[model samples]
Target: MTITLLGVVGSPSPGGRSFAAARALLDGAAAAGATADVLELADRPDPEAIQRAIEDADGIVFATPTYRARSSSLVKGVLENTGRGVAGDTRAPLLGKATAIVHTGATAHHFLAVDDLRDVLGGFFAAQVLSPGLYFEGADYVDADGIPTLTDRARELAEAHGRAFAEFTAAVRAAPAVRALRPLL
Candidate 1:
């Protein structure tokens, strides 16, 4: 079975750092024999369609740019639309699905925002989120034709994370029986 990885980017700009990172991650996933695509929230995509895409994907990468030591509002909005709060609804589409959280910030101070996302995906959605989520700061980028771009090291790391995410997602999909082990709440 072919694995499909979906990247949900929360950047407001199309070709900014967040988008570039997502593309690089997808590139690595493709190299690993998995198909990948990105869903940019800036385009004001339909919530229902986003949920459907999430359901179809084998794994997901939630990429965002940290704003004031937190995830962008765009990311928050999409997650809210895709899955309701655990106490309110049982719509946990991310259940048992592997996920990777990626974030870029003006400084390293906001790296913990990635952890916040990880908690929501794992604690609320029951997603198998990957550890040591990728974080890149403004300094990690260089001027490429007067545009911010990821350094070679950052790009390589994102690609490696993508490869790992693909392998992990494939493993999770293969072990459907493991879903039975989840809590019955």
Candidate 2:
């Protein structure tokens, strides 16, 4: 069975490297036999829209670009919104869904952003998170040809994450307890 994935792009810049990273993961997921959709949060700042989208997916991949050593405010807002009650369903939809992260930053100085995200997600999301979130230095996305693509390292990581998430989501779907309940976004 195919699982639905929602990839939230948090770059806030049109067609930037962070956008490319999210696309690469979707490609990897597609190759792994899963269907995917990308939510370009940069284009839409509405947290309600983001929360609503997450409700329909089986897993989530958060893609962000580090700004001043942290996730952009837009991504932070979206993450915060996920914790709120929706549609008389007081439960956070993200509670049961698998989540992973991929991020890009200009320098090693910003590398801490990846772990910071992991900690934040882990604090609220816990083992639902995949281990060792993927990280790419911003320069890695650039090419002499000017068309951006994932680095070999990134491609490897994306494939692993894609495949694992597929399995993780399937297990979530098979749990007897939630069979009668709405999906955890």
Candidate 3:
């Protein structure tokens, strides 16, 4: 079974840290034999396109740079709009699907941003939010090509997160309920 991993970059600045981190995660997923697609929010402003992508994806990886200790408006807009559709359904469109978050900031102080995203995504959308959200202290860890030069510990963390996401998606797809939902997708 093929798993679609969609990465949504929520940084307004072109080729910013958030975008780099999102690309790294996508590359990691792809290297692991998962099909991955990336949506740069700066390039795609239409909510319909984003919602369609979300609906079509098997798992979502949301990446954002900390803006005032919260997600960027672009990210929030995508979530708020798409989330509205799945609000009432116990089986949210994103429900039972794997979700991983990545956030970057100039300082380690912005770490709370990931927790905030996890809380909202878990409570509102019912996604299986993966733990240990990837946090980058600075953009230097990721080069211009979007390759992450992670330290041993960081690389291990990222790899573990990627594997967990892949495994969760595989398990979800194997479930009877998810199998029933596949026809509709």
Alpha carbon lDDT at 30, candidate 1: 87
Give a tens-digit lDDT track for model 2, residues 72-127. 88789887666633456474767556677888887667777888887776565432
The count of residue-pair clashes in candidate 1 stands at: 0
lDDT (tens digit, per residue) of candidate 1 on 1-185: 89999999999986788888888888888889899989998898888888899989999999999987677899888777765324676565687888898899888988898889988877767788989888899988898997777899988988998888889889988988754334234
TM-score for each model: 0.91, 0.82, 0.81
The global C-alpha lDDT for each of the candidates, from Candidate 1 onward, is: 0.84, 0.74, 0.74
Model 1 TM-score (2 dp): 0.91
Candidate 1 CA-lDDT value:
0.84
In model 2, the runs with Cα more than 4 Å from the true position are 84-91, 125-127, 144-146, 175-185
| The best candidate in terms of lDDT | 1
TM-score order, best first, reads: 1, 2, 3
- Candidate 1 residue-wise lDDT at 13: 81
- Candidate 3 lDDT over 73-116, as tens digits, reads 88898876764233264334565566789988888888889999
